[model samples]
Target: MSARPRPLMAALALAAVTSLALGAAPAVAKAPAGDEFAHPDLKKTYEATKKYESEQAAIDDGYVRTDDCVEDPELGGMGYHYVNPDHIGSTDPTKPAAVLYAPDHKTGKRELVALEWVVPNTGQPRPRLFDHDFDGPFDFEPVGPHYSLHAWIFKKNPKGVFTPYNPRVHCTPCTEDHAKPDEPKPAHPKS
Candidate 1:
């Protein structure tokens, strides 16, 4: 028998009740069409995020960052993301932390377009980012084995932030204006 024994059952029950209460919360928001930055009371977050000159600056404010060197084969690249260290595994959404995004492929330009709240897995408590039982808004993702939720509080996302991926968000550097350098050209067929 595990040292904790049946404590897991009690913890699970508490999580279930917490999730139910959160589900009844002012429902996850919907992004306005063409206005991906539209979210209620998001202006404050936008303003706060804008103060940071770069991802490093955000990191200076206790934002933990995770970055991938190369771009994802399909999605191209959006530099990296910074999450608040304090809220990494906490369930309090009172001040909902912001997830700063850098879309310049490591060019150092980042934006505050979304908010994220995560719950770490350490016998603390499981998060309730979903509406249905055991189902989460971002069920496939985990932060340090913890559950997480996002809100595009700063930028306008046709795909609501509460949902997994934002449809309107794109790899800015992948655009023709910011195209990759010296890409291989296709050979012409003999006419």
Candidate 2:
């Protein structure tokens, strides 16, 4: 094979530069085997969410509610979504009502994608895995006074549990259900 053409190389270089300039590249997720549960400080909180790792177990325990799916792009894409349950256990650190799920290609079931930790609002800035560098939305921040952390235990999040988006997660079009008139949505407001 002959060497690549100069024009083709130039086009490829230009495309790479353009994508980086536009911040079009997807974020890398974190490793799935996070031992936050082993942290002495967060032990209880981690234990609290263990059951939620199983979507059905969480639903039966009132940790989730049926028909709570909604359009969310943070996890993967259009088919990805967040589900808020009727109850969240543990007051010590507080657990997230929003459980992220993705449609399973082979099983045709909503498989658990991630679990979030929703801490109470204490009038301070939200939390993050890092200190003060988390500039994303409060609901996804893993640290801070009133913040949240999305733990991608079920799914691999190359960007880590604290990161905002997970490229591995996604949802199917028209898979979401309308929220009840009186029910409030999980506070995943856009920034």
Count the clashes in each prediction. 5, 20
* Model 2 CA lDDT for position 123: 64
Model 2 score (lDDT)? 0.40
Off by over 4 Å in 1: 1-57, 69-79, 94-98, 104-108, 121-144, 175-191
In order of appearance, the predictions have TM-scores of: 0.47, 0.47
Could you give candidate 2's per-residue lDDT for residues 32-115 as a string of tens digits?
254543234344444555555455555444432333233344343312223332322222343554555566655566555665
Task: Report residue 107 deviation for candidate 2 (angstroms).
Answer: 0.6
Tens digit of per-residue lDDT, candidate 1, span 1-191: 11111222222233233221111112122333443343444444445555443545555666555542212333322223454545555444443443545453444344445555555455544455433111122322223344455555545544344543444444443444433468643221110
